[model samples]
Target: MKKIKTPISDEEISELQIGDKILLSGVMYTGRDAALPQLVELIKKGKTPINTNGIAIMHTAVSDAGIAPTTSNKEEIESTIPFLSENGVKIHIGKGMLNDETKKALNKNNSIFVITPPVAALLTNNVLEKECVAFENEGIEALYKLKVENIPGIVAIAHGKSI
Candidate 1:
C-alpha cells in the first residue's frame, strides 16, 4: 500500500492509479450535503475559511456516533466536486461512483477520488483531532477539519480512469 500525506503534491496525485490502496495521513476536511456548496460559495466570494490548495475532503459527517463514508454521488455533493477540484482540492474521499463529467474534471485539475471503508470504527480510530470549521449550525453535518493518520482508502478514480 502507498502511504500518502496531505496536502498531497501534484506529483503524488499524478503517480496514483485507480485501485491502488493507500494510507493517508495529515489534515483533511469533511463535508456532506449541507456544507460543501456553502464552501464553494465562500470560495467564490473570496471568504473561504480554510485554504483548499492541495487538500483532501472526505464526504462524511462527524458526530459522537463516529465517522463513515457517505454517498458522494448525491446531487449536492457531486455538483461541488468539479468546482472544488478546480479550486485545488487534490483528493476527494467518499463512497459510490461519480459521473463522467466529474471524472473529467478531476483529471483536468490533477485531482483524484478515493473511497474509504464504510466502517466507522476503522475511520474514527484514525482521527487524531477534529474541529468545526464552518456551518456549525448544521450540527454534525457541518464542515469539519480533521487531523488523521493512516486513514485507509483506495484510489477509485484517477487521471480519468475508474475502478
Candidate 2:
C-alpha cells in the first residue's frame, strides 16, 4: 500500500491512480450532509474557518459509535465536491460513485476521491485526536478536525478516472 501524509502535495496526488490502496496519515477533516453545506457557504462568503489547501476530508460523522464512510453520492454531499475541490481540498474520503461533472471538477482541481472501508472500529483505531471545528450545534454531524495515522483507503477516483 502507498502511504500518504497531509496536506498532500499536488505531486503526491498526481502519482495516484484508481484502485491503489493507501494508508493516510496526518490531519483530516470530517463532514457530511449537515456540516458540508455550511462549510461551502462559509467559503463563498470568504469566511472559511480552516485552510483547505491540499487537505483531506472524510464524509462521516464522529460519535461514540466511531467513524465510518457515509454515502458521498447523496445530493447535499455530492453537490459540494466541486466547490470543495475548487477551494483546495485535494482528497475526499467516502464511499460510492460520483457524477461525471464531479469527476471533471476533481481533475481540474488536481483532487481525488478515496473510499475507506466501512468498518468503524478499524477507522476509530487510526484516529489519534479529534475535535469539532465548526457547526457544533449539529452535534455528531458537525465538521471536525482529526489527526490520524495509517487510516486505510483505496483511490476510487483520480484525474478523471474512476474504479
Candidate 3:
C-alpha cells in the first residue's frame, strides 16, 4: 500500500494503477447523488461555489458518527460522474462498479476512481473534521468538506491514455 497526501496533482494521479492499495490523507469532499446534480446545475448556471479542480470527492453524505461509501451504479450518480470529471474533479471515492461511460469519461479526463471499504466506523475515525458545505436541506446528502487522515481505499480505476 502507498500513503498519499491530498492536494494531489496530475503527476501523482498518473503514478496510480488499478488495484493499488492506498491510504489517503488531507482534504476531501463528500457528496451523494443529491448534491452532485446540484453541483452540475450550479456549474451550468455559472454559480458554482466551489472550485473542483484537482479535488477528490468521496461518495457519501457525511455525519459526525461516520461515513460509508455509496454505490455508484444508480442512474443519478452514474450520469453525474462524467460531468463531475469534466468539471475538473480528479478522484472519486465510492463503492461498486462505475458504468462504462463514466469509466470512459474518467480516462478521457485524466481522473481516477477509488473504492472505499464498507467500514463506516473505521472511515469515521479517519475523518479528523467535517463540515457541511452546501445543500443543507438535503441532510445526509449534503456536500461536506472533510479533513481526513490515512483513509484506506484501493484504486478501482486509473486515468489511462485509452479506455
Q: How many backbone clashes does candidate 1 have?
A: 0
Angstrom error at residue 73, model 2:
0.4
Structural similarity to truth (TM-score) of each candidate: 0.99, 0.99, 0.94
Clashing pairs in 3: none
> Model 2: per-residue lDDT, tens digit, 93-145?
99998999999999999999999999999999999999999999999999999
Query: Is candidate 2 or 3 superior in TM-score?
Result: 2
RMSD of candidate 1 to the truth, in angstroms, is 0.5
Q: Write the per-residue lDDT of candidate 3 for residues 88-111, one digit (tens) a residue.
A: 888899888776788889998888
Candidate 2: global Cα-lDDT? 0.97
Per-candidate total of colliding backbone pairs: 0, 0, 0
Clashing pairs in 2: none
Better of 1 and 3 by TM-score: 1
Q: Model 1, stretches more than 4 Å misplaced? A: none
